[model samples]
Target chain A: MAETRTRGRAPTDPPASFVWTRRIVLTLLAVFTLVPVYAMVSSSLKPLEDVQGKFRWIPSEPTIRPYIDMWSTVPLARYFVNSVIVAGGATLASVVIAIGAAYAVSRYRFAGRRVFTVTVLSTQMFPGILFLLPLFLIFVNVGNATGLALYGSRGALILTYLTFSLPFSIWMLAGYFESIPRELDEAARVDGCGPVGALLRVIVPASLPGIVAVTVYAFMTAWGEVLFASVMTNDQTRTLAIGLQGYSTQHEVYWNQVMAASLVVSIPVVAGFLLLQRFLVAGLTAGSVK
Target chain B: MTSAKVSAAGAARAEGAAAAHGAGPGGSTGGRRRRRLPGKALPYLLLAPAVAAELIVHVVPIAVGIWMSFKELTLFYIREWSKAPGKGLGNYRVAVDVDGAIGADLLRSFLVTLAVTVLAVGLSWLLGTTAAVLMQERFRGRGPLRAIFLVPYALPVYTAVMTWAFMFQRDNGMVNHVLADQLHVTGGDRPFWLIGNNSFWALVTVIVWRSWPFAFLVLMAGLQNISRDLYEASALDGAGVWRQIRHITLPALRPINQVLVLVLFLWTFNDFNTPFVLFGKAAPAGGDLISVHIYHASFVTWNFGTGSAMSVLLLLFLLLVTAAYLLVTSRRRPAHG
Candidate 1:
């Protein structure tokens, strides 16, 4: 925001020739960022032999075979559906719950409020993988008892995804909600509204940016997360992250198809971020700070 | 004024109720009491769902996980609906001490994780701070540079990772191609970037590239928050740029620096996707990290017990490292509230 005042360099700042040199340097740095992504696209477009063969900037005989083989050979579409369903559901549920909890924590003081805050903070400290064994045991036990084993099921993955998203969402939104002026809520209440009504009519609508940021964070974690998705679900319900792993086998590894599938899975998240780039930066910075 | 108004209104009701009780035992207390209780209970009721979800989704799993860690647990035996065979500390023994089974992959995994965390955090801090300082200058295109630098952090794991893998491919890879062609180091033959010992640095490079942007964003903000007057005043006092950085920028950004390091350490230590995706499955035989090892034990062997045990050990190792870091850092400076 302070950048407005510092947009252009002064005439007395540096020599005129140095301007081109600076531009060239900046372009080179930008290339460092783009080169890897370009290579990915190029490799995905090439045939398997071309990718594995001698070095070529552009594929010697570029073909759409990898993209074609990606869909036909792998269960990538199914994995995408599973990822969508699981991540979508978790993000929705976590956002709603986070909004409610954050509003209460931010707007009111009650007994054990400090305890609640500390617990939420402490939850992020433990690595999610630490829970894999116990969770597997619990899921297995529940499955046995109820005749509905969640182990390797889509439900298990959904549950695991929540462990990361929900804690983060609550902490982030609580910070955002605390920043909203309490006068707004008090005014809403004065206008013949109860707490829930005030939140719905006032706070929720006002805090849209923070909520959207949390939603993006949640969705990204659930959709792109590999550790839990890989551990909790097996072949039948494999998410895209795990399905990407299936690109290689005992003998031959299909590098081209793997890159293609990886691109397919990554597109939605990248597009979502690009669309919401402004809000993403704002939301993330706000969440990280007080 | 509003809070005073609300408190006055509440006091009036309370005083009226007290007056009623003082007047006689004739007034019905239940209705007035219920109103007071609901007004107090509403916030808690709204928070109940989140608290319950956290309990069920996070705390319960951790509770059960820690309990299982103490006992020898298996999904297969549980599938048979048999009671868990309790083997106290056996899992921990094999997991921590290695016991000469499965070689030293677990230990190697721990060391590699530590190395990656240290390298990523240290380099990112150095680069990010430098970038933040450079960007802070009244230069053209600073705004666009800040936005473009966030491209990697904003990238989806799948897309960024696919791109990274493409760049680091052993043969016909873009990086090696560039190294061979324009750089002219290899006489136009491709260099192997992802094979043998090269896999370690390759993994490190990809992880650093994808993650440094995150540190950059944080450091940039931290830098911007500082008052430029400090720099101008210090410059007038004849402090060199390096001295100004050491005295003013470094000390001022210390809190964020610690947090960034800790976060980068924890996340990188737990990272699975970067290395797993970059190297593909079966990590060049000897290059397996702990997360990859856990995947192998659980998925490849279908041995949940060993997997669980390994996870428990990994957790312990991370906790120790985190503790040591905290101990050392906190000792350097008194704890901040």
Candidate 2:
């Protein structure tokens, strides 16, 4: 990796003052990052009343009751399942579709290549709310016309998330694929492999880091999404974002349970992201040039 | 991956190869054009889903949204939005009229969003650049520190914002407990964070914490490209650490920084999740980002026409800003590939 070239310290040994400054800055930044997280985690462990009246650095009576009660309190298990299905489905579909489109852009040039590229790039800048109402109307209309249940279905959420994820994924993956040398794919083609075969065998294996990075990103975006979930989802399809927000709005907000549920929901993605963090760094390094 | 990093060199080779092999048909990746009858249709077939997805999700919806904006499409006409009577500029007029209630409120949210976007993006970039540079040096425990630094980014957005909302509670929140009780920064009385003026900073806080790590990651990737030789040369020429950073590091990172800063700006401006999760449907006046504000205008207020008009204006403003930004940046680096 090009990064290995610059990993070590430069020829000069830094002065003590520079070392101290770096330590202080890094420490301060890390504290800034971790304190709120600590607040959330510590608060989640406290009993209900303990989190309601005052902020305690340490819970006076530490308990896991919030974790125990959070599921029963709001059907949190159901919402978690819904989030997993919707976000996971969306990520899978986006990656699969984006692989084809990104390969098309990076490895071939069609007549509308620049148009498709520019359109996807600019489309990213539009806010989600711009399309929410019309898309809702379209969903409703389609459901009415075809009886497909497009408005309040989990599939609807997946489709909407694809809207959010697909374009950017194509744009990004194309850049990553562009960074990969073209000779490898050519060599595969010469060995009696077609485009799909070359893409699957050579490009796919070589760009695992980029694919994983995009997959995690798309999943996280859908997982925590609030806007579309609020409107597109119904009682049966409530995702964690809407479910937790609804829980917090209930009378006598259960701060502890809400925090507990949030923690439980966050851990999977956080752990997955941390485990794959190195790939993301390498992937972005390859794509960042363009 | 390293073997594949020949985009710059391979282009020269690709041209030579293309000429030698005789360009039968063009647009091949690295080799000369391969025009087998079956291969000719493959790229379009591959791109079909992407184009269709764009049309159905983005292009069609945008066109329909524009049509709705020009009509009196409110809750009354939501079911049959296509039949909503056209009002031409009536919806836009109400949205832009400064003295009118809706327009004034919309203007306030826009300004608030502008301020928050500026502060958050600037601070995130600064903190991220600082951390990336600091982390560039080889040190013990750097890996763990980098992971810890990215925790906010990795954590669910709702989780982080909800934590802030809890922490910013008037009586029970930790912001007051630490700043007032421990540090005595608040004037005797505990100030509210989710409402009134302080909500802006509270909004900015969550935005910066979650997004700075992204900037940090990108800049760190960018920093790896800068050769140590540049730093060594500067050091031998009597340049101090700060001088080397200012002259060598900053200039080396210009291209990536341009892309990073723009991305951060766009993300922060378009961010509805933070404000929505933090303040809920009816965002406070001070922290009402335009995205949430438009959501409120359309959904909460049940005035889709006005909301759609605001959306059009926002889109236009973003496009204009992006065009101007690109033009200025390109002029500065006209030779950039």
Interface RMSD per candidate (angstroms):
11.3, 7.4
TM-score of 1: 0.83
Best by lDDT: 2
DockQ of each: 0.34, 0.46
Best by DockQ: 2
**Model 1 chain B: ten consecutive residues of lowest lDDT:** B1-10
> Can you give the lDDT of residue B317 in candidate 1?
75
- Model 2 CA deviation exceeding 4 Å by range: A1-8, A179-183, B1-38
Clashing pairs in 2: A181-B4
Tell me the TM-score of model 2: 0.92
Which candidate should be chosen as best, given TM-score against the real structure?
A: 2
Model 2 chain B: weakest 10-residue lDDT segment is B1-10
Candidate 2: which docking quality band?
acceptable
Q: What lDDT tens digits, residue by residue, belong to model 1 across residues B181-300? A: 679887866756667777777777777777777767667666656777787777678776566667997888876676667767666777777777777656754346667777776667
TM-score of chain A of 1: 0.87
